[model samples]
Target: MTTGRYLAAGLLAATALPSAASAGVTVTGVSGDPGFLTGRIIYTPGGIGGNAGTTSADLSIGRMKFTGFDTATAAALAFNTYCIDIFNYVQNGTFDLQTFTLGNAVKEEQLKALLSNTAGLIGGAATLGGKKDISAAIQLAVWEIVNESGNNGYSLSGGLFQVSATHGSAATNARALAQGYLNSLGGWSAQPGFNFSMLSAVSPANNQRQILFAPVPEPGTWALLIAGFGAVGGAMRRRTRTRLAYA
Candidate 1:
């Protein structure tokens, strides 16, 4: 078991931009416990289309074993750290926990209905030829609820998402569920979400756990991004003028 925390090199970047910020996940406080595995995973960001397509790629961190038994406080604190970072990057300020509410549980019936309505949704990948994959973006949202709510009810290992049916260990049953929906809809077509990233539990030793898919920021999020650039630029101009007057 590894114990030292190191940066997650080779992190996945759907698209890379010279100025684009790097992304990754690390879970703290829960260490060496079989129940929780949160480690740091980092990836570089670059793409041919610059940051535009990269923004479209959803952030999919692999499976988080949510059993709905969360104490809320610890989880909220942990999740908020990243939320604050993201908020600052987009909103130009620190994140307040009050702004984020705990989510409700997602029962099996509700999930089934969601899939039925969203059959065949898909999105283009950010890497390579911009490969298209089943983009059931909504499923990722539901996953978050299940995790936080502790609905350990149906899961990939044995629940609705069986590893064998998914065709590979590297995928979530949610992905398979998305693919199945596509098959019925005559294959993958344009969907609302893209660039979804997977989340995995990491051990303090830097070991990987099950993957959970996390949805990325939507276009509207970037639109809301508040920046200090304007203030800085104005201050710079004023300072320059003062220097010239003194000269």
Candidate 2:
């Protein structure tokens, strides 16, 4: 009986452990100074008890595909940080983000084709690109435009990254995404060529303002936890009652 009880307790503990999920966003050649550019955003959704949305390999990643990164490497962080800054940098040019209009596939394709060439990027030309595919196809496009236009602070070698955003209320998603990126920075105080000062709204100087990276709890995680706790408690109570009866 004692052995059975111990086994039950162990099972409960295992069931209560945290959970994770996967959400993928693919972008390429982001634009900015010191951009951690990429074509793929490497992320796995996760968190501790009561919170586990996702964790990214880099907060933002860039176009270059260098392998064998030690999670602690500055290059890794540079990639993730690029994802965070891409949005703000994209619109710095004379071209408005909304210029990517609906039903204008030709211009959108032109924009994509134009930005694909890292060697020949020119910003003024991006003013012609429309916003029809703004959210979906524009990540790399934005980086290309911004960099070509000299809109952001990213150096010539550092203007790209890939990042992702999953589902949630806009605010919750922002908070979690920003928090997730910040957390990914881990204990490192600096990210090589990347500038932390640019993140004025959520930097250490500003006490890390919150944005919605909506961290939804892992599916079935909460239910399993509750059931496991109840099971453990019930077993404990039953053992106590049994002892009392014998006494």
Global Cα RMSD, each model: 19.9, 24.8
**Clashes found in each candidate (C-alpha, N, C closer than 3 A):** 34, 49
Worst window of 10 by summed lDDT in candidate 2:
224-233
Best by lDDT: 1
In angstroms, the error of model 1 at 192 is 4.9
Per-residue C-alpha lDDT of model 1 across residues 1-247, encoded as one tens digit per residue? 2222111101111111111132233232221101111121111221201231221112322211111112223222121101101100111112111111123323333333333344323222353211112222233323322222244333333432222233322144344553343233333232443222223222222122211112244432210110110000000012212100000
Error of 2 at 163 (Å): 8.5
